[model samples]
Every structure is written in structure tokens, then in C-alpha cells.
Target: MQVVLRKLGRGSRAVVGRLVRAPRKGSVIVIEFSDGMHEYVTTPVKRVLRLAGREVFYIETVNSRYRLEVRGREVALDGAVGG
Candidate 1:
């Protein structure tokens, strides 16, 4: 999916974007930004198993942490700026 990091919040922040490729259960999708930053969010098949049949799936990421959800993806920047 293509998303723009508009505002960064302290806790769980909402990511606004268009579902370019409707994510599937257990599917690991890549989120790319305008500034060339990318990150992968892996959906637990069990968590999204029900939504697997749907065309789009929205997932959430851990907040207030600076750990790279995965490798190769750029680390998210502090404040409201794309990494």
C-alpha cells in the first residue's frame, strides 16, 4: 500500500492510505512512503483469517517503540516526518 506519514502520535497512530493491494491473511505487505521509506507489517493469519476473503485488510503496528518491525525497512522518524 502507498501511505503518507502525516502526523505521528505518542501511542498507536492511525496510518491513512489507499489499499493498492488488498492484503490477505498471513500476508506480509510492504508500506512505502513518498520519501522512499518502506516497512513491512506481517498480519497474523489467525488475526486476519476471517478477513482473508476480503479485498482489503487494515492492520495496526506497535506504537512508542523504535524497533524495526523488520529488516531493510527504514526506521520511522520521530515527530511528523517520513523516515
Candidate 2:
């Protein structure tokens, strides 16, 4: 008998995009990034992940979970609604 194995793509469940954290404002920091086409936003955030050298970061909030993928300077983020 022969068995078949499937391969998984690099696609993730979280929203994938490019986003960078701002220089910090007051008591919070801002995330300014490109949506693969455009840039936007500034909000209070709680950092929960930071792994250098080809790794993904995951941050969880009261209502959402954010996954950040880093590649040198180029980065990717995944946002899951409703945590």
C-alpha cells in the first residue's frame, strides 16, 4: 500500500501584511505599515513577541491576536479578529 502526504503552503490564518512600530507616543506606540499597497494606522499596543533572524511574533490583545513575521527589514503581520 502507498500513502500520500500533502504539503502546506506558507499561508496563515491571521491577516498577513507589512507593519512597523512607531517611535512610541505618550504611554503607547503606533504601528505604521503598508497593506501591500498602502500605509495606515496608530493605536495602543501590547507587545508579546520579538524573535530575530527569520521568525514570527505573536501578540494577543483583549479582542484580537496579531502574528508578526520578520525578515531583516521587510516584515509581515497577521491579525486574527476576536480573541
Candidate 3:
């Protein structure tokens, strides 16, 4: 498996990490970060798709007006503030 890291946001230096597991289709991708915060991302076979000939899936989470793009392709997860 291979892991990649990317940085996002400001004022706290948010860190991002990603892992590609074996079995390809039904592999669980675990994501973690600093500040004792972490999220578990499970990759189901249904989410897998051949994008430009490469397998890919997406996972995201939003909390307290902070948008988090956890895994897979590059996309922003928007969060709402003060509903």
C-alpha cells in the first residue's frame, strides 16, 4: 500500500494523508491527522470506478464550518456555519 500527504486550510496548518490498500475493490482506507482528530474511511466495491482508466473513490466530511476532503479525487466538502 502507498500513502500520500497533502496540506489544506490555514490558521492551523491542516494535514491530509491517504492510503491505497490491497484487494483494490473492498479495501478500507484509514485516514488520520494531528490534534488527536481522525476519521475512518471504508471503501466499498460500489464506490470504485474506473476514472480515466484508474480506479478511484471519494470520501469527505464537514464539521463546524470546516470543510474536509478526506480521500479519493480532489474535491471540496463544504460545511455550514450557524444554522
lDDT of each: 0.32, 0.35, 0.33
How well is each residue in 33-80 modelled by candidate 2, as lDDT tens digits? 334455333234444554554355455433344544444443233231
- Candidate 1 lDDT over 1-83, as tens digits, reads 34432223466454443323433334443455444565544442222211233323223333222212222223222211111
Residue 4 of candidate 3: its Cα lDDT? Answer: 37
lDDT of 1 at 62: 30
State residue 52's C-alpha deviation in candidate 2, in Å. 7.5
Candidate 1 off by > 4 Å: 1-10, 17-20, 47-83
Q: Quick one: best TM-score, which candidate?
A: 2
What is the Cα root-mean-square deviation between model 3 and the actual structure? Answer: 11.4
Q: Local error of candidate 2 at 30, Å?
A: 6.2
Best by lDDT: 2
Enumerate clash totals for all models, in the order shown.
0, 1, 0
> Can you rank all candidates by TM-score, best first?
2, 1, 3
Candidate 3 lDDT tens digits, 1-83? 22232222455443365443321333344554433366545433222222233332232223211223334544322211111
State TM-scores per candidate: 0.33, 0.36, 0.29
